[model samples]
Target: MLSVSGDVSASTNFTLAQIQALPANTQTVSFGSGTGQQTHVYTGASVWTLLNQVGIATNPAVKNDVLGKYVVATGSDNYRAVFPMGELSPDFGNRGNQVVYAETLNGTSAALTSTDGPLRVTAPGDIKGGRYVSNLAKLEVHTATSTATATGGGVTTQFQLSGAIAHPATYDLAALQALPAVTRTIGANTYTGVSLWDLINASGIQTSATVKNDLLGFYLVATGSDGYRTVISLGELSPDFGNQPDIVAYSMNGAPLPGTGFARLVIPNDGKAGGYVSNLVALEVVSAPR
Candidate 1:
């Protein structure tokens, strides 16, 4: 059985038969394995669909409150992985992650082996299988601090970049412009700034590279002057993984961000603007709780 709990309107357990009944979703995925690279088709239900069924709680008064939430998926063997709400939401990252119970290989329907499981978590967008947790056991949703208020008025000139890093530094507009520039075109406007991946690397992630999958469970929180906060999974922004081109844009249409701020967090692929935090003030790196 799979147990679901944490910050949800309903907490329940579902058996394999019940999970297989919730609108079957099929995905063809390729990832690295012990032998070599392998590909297979997985069948299950969307994680987003399951979260909705249980109802993730959010504050109606808080702007984009759901963006600050995340879910931790734990396997029976104690293996774990995390998925930020932004990455799973249809309005935002829309990654289409699945909780699979069956596999299809070379046109043959195969039941998931006991070693792999009757239930497994699969992230099709990930370049690696580190997050493809097997023998699924629990799903817990968690909300970060959300005390957003009206904009603090005026353009922000500087913001602190701290949390889980070797060197927590303060960056101003000029400091941002000095780093390598990455340009992106969004609809009619053009944005130029530093890649979020580069920015994080500059501070140096404190995780041990030798420790396998240590960084997979880490995420970043971007906060605006208004206290608006949004959580982004580190895997979602890594070039070797999800590879989404998120940036901290300082200039738009070749001009300094006018009233918005000196810098802004831009998620180019979001279907909605909830993750676009303007008047950027702080960025914090955090690890998912065990």
Candidate 2:
């Protein structure tokens, strides 16, 4: 049985038959494994579609509130992986992650082995299989809640980078502009600033080299001056995985962002502006619980 819970209008469980009944999509993907790289073809329903069917609750008052949420996929062995809502939303990251029961391994209808799974979660975009959790058993969704309260003031001139890292530091507007600039465009607007991945890399994420694909289980939270927080899985931004070109923009259309702030998050492909955190204040990196 696979159970789904957390922040949904209705929580539910599903059997293998039921899961296969939902809209099915087939994908051919390859990822690194113990033996080396392996490729497979899978058919299953999109995680985003499943969330929508169960009714993901979002604050209508908050702009793109769903972007602040995340989904946790747990296997029967208690192995877990996290996916941010923004990464799953068709209008945003458009990632086609799935909960699959059928597969073609090595061009054979081998399906899933009895020991491996009757159900498994697959991330087609990942270069490694770390996020492709097998024997899937549960999924829980939660908001990346923040306690920081908004202060009535002028636009923010700085932001802090702190969390599980070797170097925890803060940066002002001038310091941010000094980093290598990465420019991205959405619609008619062009944003120029540093890449979020660059900032995290500079902070030196704390992880064990012995653990294979350990970084895939990490994530980061971006908080705005208004206290609104949004989650983004580390894998989503890693060039080795999702490869999203998200930037902490300081300027738009070659002009300073006076109304927004000296800096803001810009998710280039987001259909909504919710994850585009304005008046950026803090970026906290986190390692998801094992």
Candidate 3:
């Protein structure tokens, strides 16, 4: 099985049929012996398409944080090769059909050799196939951090946004509720605050046109006053923009917290509160390196 994880709103484990179900592209790239190299046809989905489906940062605004990210493809034999996120994205830098998770070799009517696939990753541009891994089993992102730890939290009284953002923005209880309101139910309680994306938008960190291709590496790191931390993708928090589930709460059950916790982060549709953190103190939007 070929699966996807990391820095995404939803993780997808793909079967052969499932992989084939996605948009497919056919490319003719050179692949043969040194004495007489020959061309071969590859049919598979684009890395950019897959990255977008699973939620990667593709906006132009987050490039400073998007650059240097990479993807790690691990094969069944445990062999792995790294592909820079920039090299696989249209906006960043992808040449021809340079990187593809090839499912069909020769033609759609021909099956990949037993050793070649169920699913194999091929870089058509390489003179040697050392990085063209076969029997691919997993693909995941790795984040690279270039920023120092943020300061000024000695006695935090509000919420803060950091990471891939252009300028850090802070929000008090009133400021949080002032943006917009969305009420959602979790178990037996109802909670309210602006969606987490609202706070992100206010922070000036955004998905710009050119940055969209290399977005999957960015994340929303939520930390609480009690040291409990939870991570979520920026995609899930974007409404009409990405997927669902971006909420921060100032009121529980239609009212403020009971003499405790200034605010809460709630992810709806989940049965547990593991990712739903309370007493939120900080939200960082750092990029993940490949």
Candidate number achieving the greatest lDDT relative to the actual structure: 1
Per-model tally of clashing residue pairs: 0, 0, 23
The TM-scores of all predictions, comma-separated, are 0.93, 0.88, 0.51
Q: Model 3, 37-128: lDDT tens per residue? A: 75667777776677667886433553233433556676787666655554455643453332244534433546566776867776655544
Cα lDDT of model 2 by residue, 72-110, tens digit: 888887777889988888877787899888877666654
Model 2 residue runs over 4 Å out of place are 105-110, 208-212
Q: What RMSD value applies to candidate 2? A: 2.5
Candidate 3: regions farther than 4 A off: 1-138, 141-156, 206-212, 240-242
What's the best-to-worst order under lDDT? Answer: 1, 2, 3
Better candidate number, 1 or 2, judged by TM-score: 1
Give the winner by TM-score: 1 or 3.
1
At residue 128, what lDDT does model 3 achieve?
A: 44
